[model samples]
Target: MSADDSVLLHTEGRAGYLTLNRPRALNALDHTMVRRIDEALTAWEHDPAVATVVLRGAGARGLCAGGDIRAIHRDASAGGGASSRAFWRDEYRLNDRIARYPKPYVALMDGIVMGGGVGLSAHAGVRIVTERSRIAMPETGIGFVPDVGGTFLLARAPGELGTHLALTGAAVGAADALLLGLADHFVPAARLSDLADGLAGAGVPETVARHAATAPGGELAAHREWIDSCYAADTVEEITERLADSGEQAAKEAAETLYTRSPTSLKVTLAALRRARALGSLEHALDQEYRIACAMLTSPDLVEGIRAQIIDKDRDPRWTPDRLAAVTAAEVARHFAPPAGPDLGLGAGGAAARDA
Candidate 1:
């Protein structure tokens, strides 16, 4: 429990507690954090003393915001994409391990869970969210296609709700997360500590039952039909056209939001989602996303988007192929093709059988 530990590891009863320690940074995952987590989880996986694992962020504001996007920005700008690739390779493996964990894995998703944060928790055996929980996959806004098995989760969402969320990068609360099957239980923020205490004794399922209650409610389900309809198109161009023409205000708003994101990301993500739907396992989706991630590292839109929205704080990104019509099928295909480097290492089983 050292204050300086980026990830604090401790054992209480049968529960292994992992605390993400960079509260000031919103517990953003870095390569060190990812490696530390991998080490801890690998060690704990076979320890008979630990029956389940509970993960949370140290700060009250949230679990984790995402991977340190600033780091990605820096690495992408440096060229070669060597650093970015290494990060994703290990991070994606952690995501897969969590999903197929041998023991119960509980994720307390409190607030601001997005991007890589979603990667760490979405596949947990039991995902518990509080009223303060805000979850999303916002890669499109930064000119990056969603990775860390995002395609698998989003592709599995009811209807095409995943498409809307992916394209818009909209943050949804606990109720919506539960509705979308992204989370398992809804606990109030105030009761989270009690919930954790119980987990140290009775384990996640029983502990969650003790504190779980009806979620306040959310609007995502109401818009499912709207989302599934507009996003049903095979391409980003068609989806936007349909959304723009729809009479519903939600559709119009969605259209506006999509317009603000990277056209390259929107198109590539759409293709990824479609491919994910046809895949047999989560590993397959990660392999597909690895290709996309490598492509994004060199894409003009990714650099410009990160500069405008993050580094420069300008909010406005002059995206190359700014319009859907300008994005060619060949260009999108190149994103899905394997980059000239070591593969993502998912192997025949993809990420599912990745070594610890």
Candidate 2:
């Protein structure tokens, strides 16, 4: 692999590892990177010499913070294009492949793993967390809906913890990731090299079994009781109401966070999660998410939300609905509606459809 490679692909003995190289941007996924990652995985999947696949980020601060939001912002600002559509279609396909790969795929999830980062790693067979792992979906904060199969994972989270995390862009540390079943193993950052060595020497299954022994409890472990109780509500409104009513400091803080996010995003996210819960597979979940994502780009909140947050660097986002309750059922329903055209020319209407 060369320095120009978006993902540094290499093989040591029977192990093939893909290192996300964009540390400056926290390994954020751009269109090129997404395509390369999928290509590497496809190659390694059939290689007789490769026994396992390892995914990691080059920088110490973040495995990947999210997608290249600057690109999305550019697209939304420039009024959409064939290129932008192609980006989402291909990116979603890569996410799907990771979720369904046959080989044992281990993600070294350290530092910030959010948005696009989650899409790449969360679906792996072995998600290994370090104490440095700080994870979230966080798309709501930027005016984008959480795609990358996040809807499926969020819907599957124990209770309303998913909804709370999504709406608030709440960060969860290593212990919490494991407790939430987001991580399969936990190892100290210092042990990452050793884990890689173990995987290469002993093969993936055995390595995973050993690593699982060292897995630790995460942030969600502490709040399980309260999270389960408060997050039981079916709707985001009800969930917010429960959080507001709770006397606990944690619950109150969560409520405040959710209240601060874009109202339109929170509403669409809740609906996406619920719809995902009823779906059959990760691809199905991403497909549902794509519909909402495409719709969001055309909606008022997205570009303005990005302008207020990332482009302007102002923390305040002026949401259209103002409050979650202000968003009507019809307004929310629009996000899930199909795009006007013949499937956007995405082929097959199969698992890959979500990707394109």
Candidate 3:
């Protein structure tokens, strides 16, 4: 149970483990940390001594909040700098590796898991959630579309829940996460230690499965009606209009949330979610996201959104479009255009035309 400073890389009996160690910022995935994780996983993949690989974050409050947005903001401010675009490429590659890793990957999703955290955990074979777990894809709130293969999982979610979450950045509790298929197992926080011990022992998978409790009833299932109806509309503007028309207190609150956000973000996000739904795999989704993300640094709304939210703490972002309805179809379409390059440096079958 002992931990180290940046990362705690150790072997607990037969299991190889890597724990994200920056608790204060909710273990946000920084560039260096992503490289370290990749290195550790690569080593573990071939290590005969390792029976299973478990990825977890330190502290009780969060597994990982997201990528270090402040860093990206700083890099973007430097004006198309060397490191800014490279970071996105490397991070996206890391996400792809995790999704295609060749082992039984277990993600201990104990607490708040957002953006980058979701990328790390969601694709794993076993995503274990506790009662305290609070998970979501909150990228749109920060003026970024959900990357980290978010499109793969969110697109696959039942009905319009994925689209709703991609747009609104809603947080779901453990029960809801289970019902939504975002998590595979639900275990109590108190039993996590015993479960980890079992995972490191002879009876690994069975032990973990035994400790898992079923998803609780209500909440997510009940709210599915409202979420589906509200998010089914064609555009963010249409969705907002529907929410406004509903007159329900929850719908009213949702409408307000949409109004307060950057219009460009909502537009880009909705388009990304729709495109991701049609994609075939995590690799495909990340590839599509890379094209959009490269263009994001040049967008006016991105810098302004980050400045207001993080740099200035103003909470007032003056998006370029000013209104969701004003974002033109051609503008949204620009994000998906292929980057000018000799090659995208992707793996097998990656160069083929994407479904969307």
Native-structure RMSD, model 2: 2.5
lDDT of 1: 0.88
RMSD of 1: 1.7
lDDT of 3 by residue, 1-356 (tens): 23235677899788888889999889988888887888888889899888788888888787899888888887888756346567767777777777677787889899899988998898888889998889998766667788888877888888888887787788988888877778888888888878877888855569887788765553667667777898888888889998888867777788888887777778888888888877777777887887877777778777787788878998887878788778888888888887654223453345342211
lDDT of 1 by residue, 47-114 (tens): 99999899999987789989888888888888567888989989988898899899999999998898
Task: Give TM per candidate.
Answer: 0.96, 0.92, 0.93
What is the per-residue lDDT of model 2 for residues 190-243, given as tens digits with 9 covering 90 to 100?
878778878776877677666554545556666767777877777778878888
**TM-score ranking, high to low:** 1, 3, 2
Q: Weakest 10 consecutive residues, lDDT, candidate 2?
A: 339-348
Candidate 2 ranges with C-alpha deviation above 4 Å: 1-3, 209-217, 341-348, 351-356
